[model samples]
Target: MPMPEQADAAKSRAPSPAVDRGLTVIERLVTADEEMTLTALAKATRIPLATCASIVYTLEQRGYAARRVVGRSHFWRPTLRLYGLASQLVRKIDLSSVAQPELRALADAVDMPAHIGVLDGATVVYVAKAATAGFIQFDTYPGKVSPFNLTALGRAIAAYLPEDELAPLLTGLVGGRGPAAGDGSAAAFRELLETVRSRGYAVEDQEEQAEVACVAAPFFDAEGRVAGAVGVTGFARDLVDERRDKAAAGVRQVAATVSQRLGCPATALPRPETVF
Candidate 1:
């Protein structure tokens, strides 16, 4: 009900806040269609060009913004450090840290390499691992990217990824062959995911290497999401029928103990000695 002049003057007189500008700059930089320029960032955030430069410089110093030499004018994009921060942020429950002791024990029990890996984007990255004192020991260092379709631990973790994310990675493949010509068989891969989900464990029989075999079970977090995978791997020739079941059972027990320690529900875990 105020006069037009009064309302207009009031709107014009309202003080613009600094936090909004800073956050807008950050958002635009993060989601821009292409690499952002200092001028474009300033324009997008409606901040002064000089202020944008200072803000970008501060962000660069903090390792949030990175500048590249595209031509005369510099371009900016985010670094992998952003994903590092995001990974730590998303993992409210630290399954890898809690599974260390059990991992060591499992490694000793199986006398092979046991590892714990969590799904990072589309890859299973090793977070913790132990190796037995065997002559043909396999090294599993932290941050190794396991193949989703070619490894037991990878299958267990990948089984829990959202459908949209899991689909593209597993688009092709008919009976282990490359994706077929319009077969509508992607449904089978989804069924495989469900089979892993229902069975509670996954097995890789010489999938990653001609001589290697692995068995893995899922570790649920506090919220009951598949937080990671705990598994053991050894030479296929070394494992006879008697040892395979024992190894699978041992891996399942260790995975459940780790899940329980991470606050997952008792009913959420699968039965031991069952393979998927």
Candidate 2:
């Protein structure tokens, strides 16, 4: 169907045969209607039996696949723990006992998943979390260390600190780039933190993960330091458009409450725009 020169050009532009064959094996495993044996995988992928076995071995080592131990041989299955690790990190941050009762009240009042987060080096760690009572809810536990640039909770805390105070905190923390914090992947975070300072609250839409949104406000201590933040996150479909403001209000109220509990007076509450 093609001219000889055109056919030659297409062949030259194509991926190496070994690379294409390897990818084909992976694609077949991903789209299979049923569990595939090494023989079946090799046949479907048009790869050698030894090569297919080697690919499976590599996938298993990386936690992408696991042996099911079906019959006399092993069947590969995907491990879900990779996804659960994110939640586990959030659950590890430590919150004081005094903060729990207020966190519980805020969680119960909003009927949404809520968490208390504090700065831990360069990351914001979830010190505590309360799951909603509803049948469907965002599931988070204490001690999760969410990416600072990617979460409303982190942004809210970033919003209130003085630029000098916060900049070094950001630059000194893990993944920070010294004085030039925005030189690398942290540029987005630097920009977002600036926006959070301009806005009254931090709002996130599908930043941490696709289809999840959140709103957060920061808590300040009597000394005027950024102590922590409280935020709510849920399915994006449930909290789209007009609902964002309500979530932001809730976050502000809870953050204010936590600040008051930490001995910050009503008059001392730092406005989002004033970084003092």
Candidate 3:
């Protein structure tokens, strides 16, 4: 057998031409400002069409590339795999310990339930939660897995995600955010994400729960990437008009605060918008 040091050296090097080509394909896809057809990809990357097609198939099987029709043309685009891979660097972060106290504070400030969640696969898993006083029989808590395309907290995290990653997931949202599924579908949810991106937060507005409404904001980590999201949930009736506006602002403030605590650079605050 080869020595340990030799094995380590071999592992660090590009294993094969195929691996190098795969990475090149991903890089070419990701760096382009827009999607590319096979011909476009070949012209851009100088790779043979058959090889490019094979690379795309491999990438699709690995969930690294998806065909999208959300904003641009129906062509292959990069997926959240990059985000997921980058987040591995933060695996050691104790998010619950880092943000629990702030979550409690946010809940108290807004007089409602609050949650801290991180993306796991296609969902956001609640890692910490602070419910309002006198709450009982709650369905959401630590470890609750929510689909990223459905909940306010999920969209909050999704908002900061690149459009390439967000588009494919939105295509799967069926019943809208709440009971108003009649007009709400994939296209509407895409529009909603656009609003969230522009406003720097997300609003549920009883789109998921009949009686519950939520306003949420994304938080960045030390690397300046979205580490997670924080949201406040309350009765729909209680979160109307000024109360809703206040809650959205409060939630955003808390998220920014927590993000600063997580070592993100201080930045200007987001503009206020009502949960509605």
Candidate 1 per-residue C-alpha lDDT over 1-276 given as tens digits, one digit per residue, 9 for 90 to 100: 999999999989875576667677877887888888888888888899998998888889988889998669999877667778767755765656776777888888778788888776656788888878756657577778865666678778778877677778776432322222123366755676688778777777664556778888778875687777888888777665877777778778888888788777899776675422
Number of the candidate with higher TM-score, 1 or 3 = 3
lDDT of 3 by residue, 1-276 (tens): 999999999889847877777888898888899887766876787778889889988888989998765565448888988889867846756777776776777778778888888888688899888887784535788999977766778888887777787767766664644663344576777778789988888887666657777788898876677878888878778888987777778778778877887778786435444332
**What is the lDDT for 199 in model 2?**
64
Error of 3 at 31 (Å): 15
Q: Give the Å error, residue 121, model 1.
A: 2.1
Q: Per-residue error at 206 for model 3, in Å?
A: 2.1
Better by lDDT, candidate 3 or 2? 3
In the range 44-157, model 2's lDDT, one tens digit per residue, is 777889988898788788766666677787676545654465457435523545466656766666567878888776678887787778677565667778667567787888
Candidate 2: deviation at residue 79, Å?
Answer: 58
Report the poorest 10 consecutive residues by lDDT, candidate 3.
267-276
Q: lDDT winner among the candidates?
A: 3
lDDT computed for candidate 3: 0.77
Each candidate: what lDDT?
A: 0.75, 0.70, 0.77
Query: What lDDT does candidate 1 reach at residue 134?
Result: 51
* Candidate 3 residue spans exceeding 4 A from truth: 1-92, 135-137, 182-184, 268-276
